[model samples]
Target chain A: MTVRDPFAMTALDAVRAFRARERSAVEITRSALDRVARHDRAVGAFLRVDAEGALAAAATLDARLAAGDAMTDRPLAGAVVAVKDVLATRGLRTTCASRMLEHYVPPYDAWTVARLRDAGAVIVGKTNMDEFAMGSSTENSAFHPTRNPWDLTRTPGGSSGGSAAAVAARFAHAALGTDTGGSVRQPAALTGIVGLKPTYGRVSRYGLVAFASSLDVVSPFAQTVADAALLYESIAGPDAHDATSVDRPVERADLSRGASVLKGLRVGVPREYFGDGLDADVSAGLRRALDQMAAAGAELVELSMPHTSHAVATYYVLAPAEASSNLARFDGVRYGLRADGRDLRSLYGATRDRGFGPEVKRRILLGTFALSAGYFDAFYGRAQKVRTLIARDFTEAFAKVDVLATPTSPTVAFKLGERTADPLAMYLADVCTLPASLVGVPALSLPVGLGASGLPVGLQLIAPAFEEARLLTVAHGVEELLGRLSLPSLD
Target chain B: MAIDVTPARVRATADLARLDLRDDEVGPFAGQLQKILDHIAALEALDVSAVAPTSHVLDLACPLREDAPAPGVLRDEAMAQAPRSEQGAFVVPQFVDE
Candidate 1:
């Protein structure tokens, strides 16, 4: 165990060190905390750090280990995991990066948070994100936009930008992020980390502040596929608290048990995704990735998901519609910030107006209009119907291939204020990622290579629902072929 | 055809969403909503009447748990974060004006 900078070790390596008794839990936790202190000022990844709690948890784990407890029961034993602020952590302030809940602390742990605790993992902090997880860039966060570690001027790509940046900057072993219309994968792509958005029902959503209920999914961001899979294993399964969680038993992913090669695997290339707006360098990088997979014996089949074009329009409708209903709970009367007015209705309006950011307000109004009695069928109804077709497109493609391959985003991380002015242009950032979210499939983003702009380009591999194991394994195979990327210099 | 989102319609939708908007916001919101609606109008071109609407892609029913009582966040604790509350209940502005 010749580890000098413990922060640089991959999460899996850190786990191995812990099991070997080479590194004490406190040492690892302290290293992670130290790194956050050093880099988080520039990164802005964390909204709140639970330093004392993390140390206490580490001390307890060390005590258990000293008592000759093998600690084999906890797969993620001693790993430091940062959670996105949207999850409700018992007695810990969970702001969801919105002023509405800036001072609100939940009375109970979210299902995934409890699972992480049970797995002997240390909760490092709550990360920053788009307020209410409504925007594509972290710029919409009420506090401040998290800068990309790769380039100080660029955004990390959000609303999971903070989590992605934390992992990329090595602020923690790994972090949990939620993906509603590509929040996790897109940021992972931009930050040059591995992000996995499991099938919708794969991970329990209990205690996760609902964004777009049906589309929202809890995901993990890590330096490697195996590390992400480890975090995935700890938090995924059936939870009685979350009715949407699948009833199936949890199966820990076995990355090594699967075939080492991508031989004979059918990989689909969606022709519609290769259309206009994809950067030339990103396209070239994706082609090179496809070629690499072919060399590894994976067969590439070009297919058309004609409804891919409709995904953005469909998602904007369905997601905001759900968000409107979900956000209605945040009125002045209940928990969260309140503004008193002459009447209840005026109070509701005043509180929301004061609480929500512009992007959240925009989406709420869009959703209210979509679900309005006069326009429901034309907007929300049509979008849902189109959503079905989008899912059907995936079903048809999966029938012909094992997984679909595409570039995670059209371009690398754009400048911080580049698309802030144009909501439509900002929405276009999710153009490639929304289709899979609409279809309810498992998707993984791996760093393929850097692009012409000298920023990272990510290759997205998507599998059918509940086929997370297959998705991760294939992603692992790809990651192995591509090798690890160099860490971004803090300069 | 692009649906027109006039300032009146925007004001009405804002009211429906329970959002308080300023005079300056109404014009911009209407204009922005119109642009998005114009983009979303592409969905209208496709004939999806034959397709069933999927609110959620998963085909699973809302599985009901056993009718068992479990310890929930205590009243005092839950009320601790409430902006305004009465005795063991959330306090709101006057709903009925006598």
Candidate 2:
């Protein structure tokens, strides 16, 4: 293979190289580790680097490949994959970027992690994230904030920022990220990469650490649309372990149509998404992408989602409410950090107080308050009902358009600590991406172009639930139109 | 009614969630919570009486599996993770004084 930088190759490309005998799996793993060793110091992307573990896995795969084993034919064989710490990896510390589980080692692999191994992913240790997947910026990580690879000073938009940064920095060909709200897509937008958040029930949540059980979906990050499609196909489908996982035939993306994927497609441009607070650069990028799709024979239909304003409020109340319930397991007894106390109640209180970070505590309290007896009807109940309205808005919109075109985040990557002081301000940054998560529809973010600030901006495509193949096909056509974006060179 | 999120209310909520908030944390927590609650207070203007609560986006019936005994997490493995384990049970603080 003439490719000098094998670490920068996409997952599909790396697999092809392995088959062609152009590169060995061990060599690819070494290259990935080398890059991570060099750049992750500055980016703070990974919480733990399993250099010995990765090499051992790679060596095993290399032996299997050399032995002409049929197992080597699976999609992601030998491709280095960085997993978000939210998912359990047997023997690897999966912290979820929270001090509560800083040294927690899962005895079994999460369903998705095991599937990735079955499909031949070389597990490169756990990545950093916002503590308990609760922040818009990775700064909420009790360990350290992961910087955007695009610019050292800016955030790689979180709570999956570490996985996003790892892929963008060429530490791995593909990485897994979990989306609850805009965690996956927003970070993908900030760092010039493709992120796909499948429908809530499409991927199993068996081993995933629950943030908002109703909203969380394990997603994938890759450099291009095709790689994302490949990664998603491997991870999609139902698992009996996760009761919510739907039993449906997984449809692979039809990229053979190439640029024709856009022809005769109805692309919805929601006016509510293009409203105020959108940065000029992001607006320009969206406009350029829309105009190009139109020129490629796609019909741009203007529409309105009136419930958009209530989405953030609905999400904050609902997600935190679920989080408070989900996170109740971290009491001092069964697993993770513990603080001794004179009494049982004090033991629970002291353990939780010292273990959780500020954002997590705030959410728990907010959730507790919302679900409390007196306020339940006012806050939690009202939010759930409004959630129905938001979902109905999407159901109605889908009747008019095949896919919705919008900004992934209203703005590009912001500076570290920019919104740390104001939690509400930080919450507002996720406005554009939250609605898709709220409704549990499939959405993907593809880089539209770099903004005036010289950072990448993304165009989000929202498809109906379980319509990932259509979403990927449309995104592939858009990628062809935008050509290739030059990723950040951390030289 | 101006619903002020007072420190007393903050401590009560924290208590419900089993988080012991220090005195220094209560003021800042109250203010932040108030701002967030106020922002979400915008949801109050809507008449959602006709709407139903959505617990999950997908319409799904509770999946039932055949009730058969299956292997569960091994006791050794489960016990390996507990903070304080005595014999075969997780040891908690003394629930009642002798």
Using DockQ as the measure, the top candidate is: 2
RMSD of each: 1.3, 1.0
> Scoring only chain A, what TM-score does candidate 1 earn?
0.98
Worst 10 contiguous positions by lDDT, candidate 1 chain B: B57-66
Per-residue lDDT of model 2, residues A1-491, tens digit only: 56888976889889888877788889999999888888899999999999999889888888987898755457888689999999999988889898899889898889889888888889887888999999988999999999999999999999999999999998998899999998999999999999999999999999999999999999999999999988898889888898999999999998888778898999999999998899999999999989989999999999999999889999999999999999999998999999999989999999999999999999999999899998898999899999999999999999999999999999999999899999999998899999999999999999999989999999999999999999999999999988978888898
Which fraction of the native contacts appears in each prediction?
0.91, 0.92
Computed on C-alpha atoms, the DockQ of candidate 1 is 0.84
Instruction: Give a tens-digit lDDT track for model 2, residues B2-98.
Output: 4589999999899899999989999999999999999999998988888999978999999988998888678989789999898989999889879
Where does the lowest 10-residue lDDT sum fall in candidate 2 chain A? Answer: A69-78
Deviation in angstroms for A252 in model 2? 0.4
> How do all models score by TM-score?
0.98, 0.99
Question: Which residue pairs come into collision in candidate 2?
Answer: none
Q: Which candidate number maximizes lDDT?
A: 2
| Residue A477 displacement in candidate 2 (angstroms) | 0.5
Off by over 4 Å in 2: A70-73
